[model samples]
Target: MATLSSFLLATSLVLAGCAGGGGGNASGTAGGGGTAGKPHVLKVANYFATDHPQNVALREKFKPMVEEKSGGSLQVQIYDNSKLGAEKEFYDGVRNGTIEMGIPGLIMQADVPKMAVGEWPFLFKDFAHAKKVLEGPIGKEMTDEMESKHGVHALAWSANGFRMFSSNRPIASVNDFQGMRIRMPNIPNYIKLGQLLGANITPMPISEVFTALEQKVVDGQDNPIATLKASGWYEVQTDVLESKHMFSPNLYIINGKLWSQLTPEQQRILEEAAKAAADYEWELLEKSYEDDKKFLQEKGIRFTTPDESFRQAMETAAGPLYDEIYQTYPWAKEMVEKIKAEAK
Candidate 1:
């Protein structure tokens, strides 16, 4: 009888231990204290000011979604206004994994000349044409090229709207630009456009443009009306031409390796968030142009709309530059032709 009782006691103890073991696991799965998984902290970097509405909207819309989807396992931090460094440096940081995210102007990729085709002055006819090209295979090719060559993955496409000509002299026709010193972003097509018009191309960073214009280093620079007003360029500039010369695209890129390392679930969240942000950016683009034009008129800034004849003259002058760029990168010509065909 004593031996039987001891056996029963041992069995009861073993079953209790098993039950306790199962309970502990269930508690851990429920995210119990002392055994929960570590949280992931993501850092986003951009050259836009922290107060920029785009940045603010992105954080407000996506930050909470990330935390919720990760079950409180992820947190995102945003650093803006080159709080890190120049735009190029921020791009390099993301490429090398020092920074996890970066938003750089499409023209900035002119550092990799093949990418300059997107910002080629007079290349895109309007927003609709540009959108068809950028969201189509041509843009995809450039995005893939950046990944293969620079180890970065592009997210979504956005824009800075159309660029206009701003200078002290009123530009009523293409001939008016002869011998003028025009500020050119460090992009090849822009320089070519200026050269075609007989203007001296002054290559400088956007941050230095105000001082350059104030000091008469450049007779003027080209940018969207919104950017011209937001950047305070009008304070030093006297005339604005609604040339609509080119459209600027803004791209968000991440390090390829880091992106691949993310879990599929995390990747999905990011892609969806980026698409939403792209839509929001488009809305902002429309409002920005409208608000800016009103403000510029009220500020007594002169606005001129070049006639069709004048537009054709400028385009004709840039024809050779386009040919040169096409010759240098034959692939660009093919892509542009392909985009044109798709639009038709």
Candidate 2:
């Protein structure tokens, strides 16, 4: 009888322990103590400053929409101001899944050589033409190639606007570029374009540009007006030439492995959010150009609008590069032709 009573007592104790453990788990799940599966965390990186339109859209619109749509199952963390890394490092991080997403600037050509065609001097007629080509069949082909060749997926194409020359001296004509020391990004196409324009090239990171201009390390730098204003280059620059030399595009990319890990519903939500952010950023570009130009004028910067003859001179000088580009990358010519045809 004692043994029977002891067995009953042990069984009751085991049942009580089970019930206690289950109750603890329920409490944890209810109180957000991680008993429920942890939400997936996505890290997005960009080199733009926080106040830049792209970052603003990503942080304000993209993040909230994604979180709300996912019902707290997904969380987006943005690292702006190159917090994650510089352009090349950001691309590497995203490709390797160390960073889930990135919007890298001119450094993309380092990974996919054919991408250089997109930034070819005088290639894009205007923002609308550029957008139409990049968002159409040609863009899809490039994105597919990116996925197949590199371990990255392109989500959207956004712009950095047309690059203009900012300098201490006025550039009213092509002759004004003679013997000028200009800061170019560490990219071959940029170097080539600077050389073609008869400027002494000083290849440097974008971060060093302002100091370089102030200290006279470089006579001038070329970038979108918004970037020039945002980087405070206008403080040292007295004149801007509306060259519209290159229309730089920023690609929102995701790590292929990380993308594959997401559920279909989650992927759809992310894709839609990315598209919305890109569209919003595109709309901001026109306003940014007007606002930045006005702000620069307020700061006593003079604007030089180059005439058609000057533009024609530039086109003639840089046109030979098309053949050189075609020879260098086997697929480049075809892509360039496709974009050109689409633009028309």
Question: What's each prediction's TM-score?
Answer: 0.85, 0.86
Number of backbone-clashing residue pairs for each candidate, in the order shown: 0, 0
lDDT of 1: 0.76
Worst 10 residues of 2 by lDDT: 29-38
Clashes of 2: 0
**lDDT of each residue in 87-113, candidate 2, tens digit only:** 878888988888989998747676667
Quick one: best lDDT, which candidate?
2
Best by TM-score: 2
Deviation in Å, model 2, residue 258 alpha carbon: 1.0
